[model samples]
Target: MSQRVPNILLEQLSDFINKEMGLFFSKERKLDLLRGVSLAAEEFGFSDTEMCINWLLSSPLKKRQIEVLARYLTIGETYFFREARIIQALEREILPAIVEKRRNTSRMIRIWSAGCCSGEEPYSIAILLSRIIPDIESWKIVVLGTDINVDFLDKAQRGIYREWSFRNTPFWLREKYFIKTDDGAYEILPQIKRLVSFSYLNLVQQESPEYLNLQGFDIILCRNVLMYFSQPQVLSVINRFYQSLNDKGWLIVGSSEASHVLFPQFRTVNFPGAIVFQKDLSMEVSRAENVLFDMEIDDLIPATTTNYDFSALLNADNSIEEEAEDEDEFTKAVNFYEQGKYKLAAELFKTLLNDPVFADNPQVYILLAKSYANTGDLKHALHWCNKGVKKYRLEFQLYQLQAEIYQEMGKLDKALDALKNVIYLEPDSFAAYFIMGNLSKQLGKTKEAKKCFENAEKLLRLKERDDVLKEFDGITAGRMIHVIESMKSMESPG
Candidate 1:
């Protein structure tokens, strides 16, 4: 075991991994890295005295082991609500403001937590959503947790953690969300299991996350994860994170992690010990990775209020519509919404609402709600949501939409209630379980969050391969379990 991996061997290992598994590990900490390589050899029955060190050099998987070595070398050290200030800012300032700003489009919020390890961080985010917004129970909320280590992800899914993981957990969360296992480990309860999702992801893997490309999330938390990487690696990871978030979205990182302020695309904002980097989301991701230019903040905001009112779209006038025969109602409304013409959509909805004969239909109410939501007027959007809920009593779609609006408004409690109603109304929907997991995570219910993610993954896997990929936003490029690269170098026992 003392036969150390040489400097050239480390670079060779990295190149080998890149060829075999499409992942790369830089060489800044080569000395600290061989330990992982040695461990992997032991794990895979390759750590043999007779295997001869040179034999280890030829195997293709030797490279793959390097990536896995990184995972084993790096420990994901975090817990439920490890930092209070960032979560507080998310609840009070970020979500609500974003909601007010995005009322004109579909109410969708996707978030990602990388290097989620044993699931505490994403679960922490879920807990915040549950506590801050009651109506979030029904949103199209997507919280994805990814890590390179498959074994760790398995533990993360189990949601049973030791006390050390909850070192900074608040008393209220401890009381409400988890139950102590027979062995004294704290396990997540079912209430927190319905809102989050997890998968295996390699940060240095050359491919753009297939699952992420389909979703331009509102927030991404890469936190302490990037600190382990070299400067080139850091820049690469940050660029990827930028591509991952939507316009005007935010990225939260550990307070002491390397200062990303020098990175051109992001603006640093201090939040207690945690610092948030606001993504200049004015531009969409370019097809080429070469477009690494700094982002530009656009002045194209739809509204200034912190909370949105969707009912406002009902003000669009119908007077001018009769003269335009070529423009159909749905088309005109959709066009205006897409073009950021909230006022035009509002006028159209207004005309429709003014017509007492056609205004009260549940369909119209749904349209009106969407219009207001598109225009960044969530209050009015909620108003329309309530109307649709009443008109189509027992339908969960309206509730789901409402829940998303509440999440955006940072009303985790309300959002949870909506999701609860959805689950109660349709036990087999499975989507409710996903939302529930996120809410629980926001409440610092790690165990619950993991369960929810597991449930969602189970449901997704039950479907056909294509269907599963479609359901999870088309992340079909790799396996759910990614074994790192460095570990593959050891000689296999004959």
Candidate 2:
């Protein structure tokens, strides 16, 4: 019989796995961890779990060794049209918009399914796109499915699935899209299968050649993948996704991850039963507001004033100039922020909080919070975010800011609670879902993390091109998708 793993050794092994793969196996999961280690030991030619643990800790694991361990750790649980609402939204709203936008342009649509297990999601996208476009042959339609698991990618490329894969699928869809095999498996029709291609991609390695080459996608779907990642790893992958997208490109993460904090750069678009993020064309405000305001001030305050009482005239001009400068303070604060003078920017933003002109502007609070955060004043940043939430109860952005502040302070529960408010306001907030997933994982609530990741994936699958994200600091939709897939592998079976 194999020797049992010691408690201390088990904890050490768990920590090693968590650090390497961003997977957390708590004390509750000790038995499962032991089993996985035992299997890994057998596969790696070690005599026992202890040997396996020592080897894993001491040696740099080869790519093939990592892949083997991943196979044991990850579970592939997916189906065609897993989330039907996303597909319906894509067919009805997102796709039409992309088609119209591209009609005069390239007339091409490129979609990527990052962490596509067994090829179901990408194939579904291809099938749906073909159904919508009559002239699909004339258009450049690229659907690529990628995963870290070579086994899953190989299975996806084979284009075969069992009955379990179609549990929720309509009969007509199965009949239309697939043919029954003699061995009780269903083989996807060649026409639909040809539309999608599968490959290996590890989202964690952002600097990899495969990741660098992935760019200019019109739509990218990454679902149920990020719940397993470390926060820094998640952030790195998200940044890559931002870089991968074309301007106005759509990034679909799981619906649960629809929070503005995760994709602060992406614009949020709400459709019936779906929420998606779009990379917006960078809008350049002409600086005309400041210029026009300045011009008006110049016009009002004449260079030479030789009228009635000089002192009275000067007082009147000073009052007018003060009022105008007050209005211009907002612009000045923003410029300070751009110039990296966070403290001054924060003070200016705070000053405007009480101004009647800025009272109703939620952006003021967001900027104030950002300024504080930039200055490492997390406490003040959190305070401003909460104040904004109280004042503008319906604005999800305030809650998102609060979550960020809480996260920065290492108050994970507070961050999770803040994200709950963001989700309450915008159910499709992918960033919130992603953050919640991370928080839940940290708390050892594996199932909850999985569900949150799944929700984010569903929402992300319906996005289109030319859609602007409401806010995405640096993270991209593509990277979030990869995170979701990476997390999916680590989720405990329900």
Candidate 3:
């Protein structure tokens, strides 16, 4: 007979994972991994490995199942033009200069969409460049979109999407670019296809990132892509990005990912709800320029002014005036919130709650609620959730939070009720529908539950983009399929 795994082995495994992945799972967190392990055991017909993982992550370890679960659960459903604000800034500030910098020289502006799931993000940037840069006819542009999932890359190269992918995209551009087929699908045009290139890139794979041969990209967009990684992984990727860029090149990331870059080599360019960073190029210029690099984090705050002298860090040969532009204080708060410092983020947001400009803004409240929720303060989280809903009854995000919070509290009925409101406000929220269906099944609400599962399946199928997210879709379909089959079996008159 095989010897059972020891408690010490499990503890060591959990410790290694915590150090490597930044996901804590002591003896208390065993249950967190239990459901997943249980499911695996039911399939595998043996509980040793799964049991070891479960025991390692149980209550004695810490209730870290959800955090551990994040590594597997979320889908990286990114496309080009993921964030409008950064895209706008790219058009206004970065692209123009990049084009000019390459004007007389190689005259080529190279860009990469690292971890691009399907072709959406790279194509979006390429299309924007084509629209903004006047000499696109003569200028050379290289855009590469890459992903680890070969299936996803294949879908990206094919360039077809169902309606959901274009939910936020402007329709007029759709007509100008994509050709609609008789069966209600859109295909990207050859011209736009020619603008970008595609390949496979598994971020955490042991192999090096694809396209190691290429260098000096004018812009690199790895937005919404970094937070999924362990800190060391992110640090490695960020360093690669720093090396890959030419001097003064820009890095556009997700609105929430600013804290991932605290290195002195990059300086932040803050916008209202977004910020981008550029490579700091002045250390080689003068000894006086080195002073900006040495400024301690403690000196970052100017108690009286509430602003940092950002230009001192930049290299501008021109002697100019010192005038602050139309800068928003809220962006700084958004940056904090994105970095997972929920307590500090909540505190920063609380101070801004009194400002009339944000007094009635539902979004600010929603952000505050998310911050509170992240910190494990369910009561305060729900309080802010209700506050957001009172004024902005139609905001679906708050409803999603309430559903999650209620579900966590084991108030299944209340969670479903909250989700029902979400459906009423926004009929197309696949997330809310999926949760509703899952919760309905969990609560044993048979007939109504079957309807929700069917609805979720329909919505997800409707939104499927060339099966680009087939694996992601498959997992959801698998969960729903079992419930749906159970309902069918229950309904049969035996």
Clashes per prediction?
Answer: 87, 45, 18
**Candidate 3 lDDT tens digits, 220-335:** 88865654454345555666787788888878765434532233467777542346878767644244235443432212111111111122111121112232455565765665
Query: In candidate 3, where is summed lDDT lowest over 10 consecutive residues?
Result: 300-309
Model 2 is weakest, by summed lDDT over 10 consecutive residues, at 300-309
Best by lDDT: 2
Q: Could you arrange the candidates by TM-score from highest to lowest? A: 2, 1, 3
For candidate 2, the per-residue lDDT at 316 reads 29
Question: lDDT (0-100) at residue 439 of candidate 1?
Answer: 67
Whole-model lDDT, model 2: 0.69
Is 1 or 3 the stronger prediction by TM-score?
1
Query: Candidate 2, which segments miss by more than 4 Å at Cα?
Result: 1-3, 281-494
Candidate 3 is scored at a TM of 0.49
Candidate 2's residue-wise lDDT over 239-271, tens digit each?
677678888888877654554455555676754
lDDT of the candidates, in the order given:
0.58, 0.69, 0.60
Q: Please identify model 1 stretches exceeding 4 Å from their true place.
A: 1-32, 49-71, 99-105, 208-214, 258-260, 272-274, 282-494
